[model samples]
Target: MFSRAGSSAFRCCRALPPAVFRVSQPVQYRALSSAAADAAAAAAASPRHPARPTFFRRALSFTGGALLFTSLGLIMVLGPAYESAAAILSSPSDAESLSLFTPPDEDAQAKEDFINSHPLTLSLRSDPDFIESRPHMKIPPSWRKHNLTGGTLMGPGKVAVPPFSWSEKSGKNFVQITHVGTDLCGHMGIIHGGFLATMLDEGLARCCFPVLPFNIGMTAKLEINYKAPAMANQYLVLRATTIKVEGRKAWVEGHIETLPTEEGQEPVVLATASALYISPKQASVSIRR
Candidate 1:
């Protein structure tokens, strides 16, 4: 019975299958390796891209990111300058003539007619002080106020010298200048405030020029008061007088008025200014013609 039992146990053990163990990589790891190899091979086969961006591509690009950045840059660069230019060049209102759309010759004829009708007979040319200073009081050689090929600050693209005069009171000198601002404008129908300031600054310096020790003057400070709107394509007069001179500094007062060609309207005060001019003792600057 023992021999039989032992033989049966041996048979049972043989009947059971032997244990199996795996030595190869996992299925998931093998698949991952294969995919990585394929991707690297594909990348190597393709052409390389440029390292730098192109100008036209960047400027004209309509891509979402590109458009957004380009628009932001433009807005940052040109805000006030663009607004001022737009307002200056916009369509003319009723008060303005149709010369912007008219032919050049016709525009000239119209300007001639206006000037002839409202002649500057008593302008700067006829002023006693102006005649006296003609020999030494030269116009700044680089006074390039845009032309018909461009634009200007006076008399329909042609700046002419109007009445100029000077006086002395309590050892202070006073100067008066007259002009017709027919072309310079910021508002469509009215004059530009900046242009008015420009006129005042230049006139103030000029007033001090004749009296300055070196015949050279520079603006240290300028303050303006705009009492009324100065009109474009109309006659204007500016005057500045020296209030006092202490060492290198001088104080000046000036005012601008609109000169009406018609009989009913009196001259209107448009703006006023007070300015300080100074002469540097040691300077190495000179202007060229």
Candidate 2:
């Protein structure tokens, strides 16, 4: 009867599942119970200490994003402001208009008194016998004359004189002119660029006049290249030539040279220039007369 019962128990144990048999063993059952308890403890602990970002980390992320956005916004707003400010600052100042002043006429008695006091006559046209009686032609009379006899070509504080003369009939159409003295210089001692440009323009115009037939020429374009600084009280001579002529246009080239102040001093090249001259609309105006 005992053997039959043992056989029956073994058959029942063989038919049961592996997991059920494993739990039936004391060592395996204790191990499974301990593992389930550890899992449950871990789940309870996770709920007590929930995952979250720290205050410092959150604050730093927010500040970084805000700074990035503010920088972009500032760039968008300040770019145009900087450009507008630069434009305003770079604009030229307005120039004033000229004023006309009339001088008082002297009577015959006053004229006689003036003539007696000042014996030397300053009239360039009247004194033909005098060596310096001729008008100061900045260029040779043969090349061309602008006829600035009755009109004042310069401001009240300015004075200019022609150094030489040339003839239109002669092939020597090119010439060198100069401007010096403290009155014409700017910035205490340096020659102003504007003044230098003006002189170049005039020289080019004078150069074209002799080349052209009859029409008065006007400056269409002038380009100056400043090679060296022009100093005050130094004689600066600008050499100009008529390079090419096409229809109503004349192309001229010029260069500025500082004359040697003392003996054996080397002449310095100050500036170079090129220009275009166009015939004026009023072609009948006599520049020679």
Candidate 3:
């Protein structure tokens, strides 16, 4: 039913290449597919932003750190105290050792009375040389805490009681009276010569200290002469005199003697000593002109 012109146009369209139309359609589809695949790859490769921590999580972290530091601080501060308490309470040997380091208790009135009422003490008190100076019943507390004397030698079975002393007002002379306990003996009954020497050295130094440029001195030389065996568990007397003083130097002589057991009895000399003590040059220099 087509006119001749229409039929001729139809024939021309059919003559166009079917292959060209197919190639054009496939090229468009390939471009659309590649674009969609590229978009998907880009979305996968992008970095994502992490969510922020909540308030409770941040607070918990801070609190945990604070608690750890506080615990460490407490350990640092209280460690020694805890150790001391544990040593004192838990270990018997440690407690006993600590007690040894502690100073002796102050003398009771009865003990004081015994030393105060001694004939030597009374004589010193009545003497004109010591009238201006009061009696001292004990050594310095610091000396009593010494590791050697206080811890080892000054206990119930050794020195037993605090020594009594009297110093002259002019610092020229000093006297000490004390009872040596039975246990202070190197032999079965005789007191140790070293112990006697220690007493003499300390006594002589003390006798001259007040007369020195400073009230402190070190023994530069010490000489001891043992006279007789000093029996233990007996009252003993030490008398020291400052022989000479030249600037920071002092020469002192002293002797240890047995206290007379009865009236009119001559005291037995046990040991004699002489010593030279010198104050520190620095301390002497610091003295006011």
Best by TM-score: 3
Write one digit per residue (lDDT tens) for candidate 2, span 118-229: 3122332144432221123222232223434212333222323333212223212444434354666668778777777876776667666756657358888888999877
lDDT of 3 by residue, 15-124 (tens): 99899999999999999999999999999999888998999999999999999999999999898667755553453331133123222455333444666676777777
What TM-score does prediction 3 earn?
0.59
- Per-model C-alpha lDDT, please? 0.60, 0.57, 0.76
- Top lDDT: which candidate number? 3
lDDT (tens digit, per residue) of candidate 1 on 1-289: 4698899999988876654213244666789999999999999999998777787777666576877998999998787557645554453432232122232465545544554345343453344444222211222222223332113433344334323344442325444434444555677767779878877887777677656656567888999999999876566766677788877777888888875678677878899999988887663242220
Per-prediction TM-score, please? 0.47, 0.43, 0.59
User: For all the candidates, what are their Cα RMSDs to the real structure?
Assistant: 15.1, 20.0, 12.8
Off by over 4 Å in 1: 1-183, 263-265, 283-289
The C-alpha stretches of model 3 lying farther than 4 A from their native spots are 1-112, 131-143, 284-289
Position 155, candidate 3: lDDT: 72
Candidate achieving higher TM-score, 1 or 3:
3
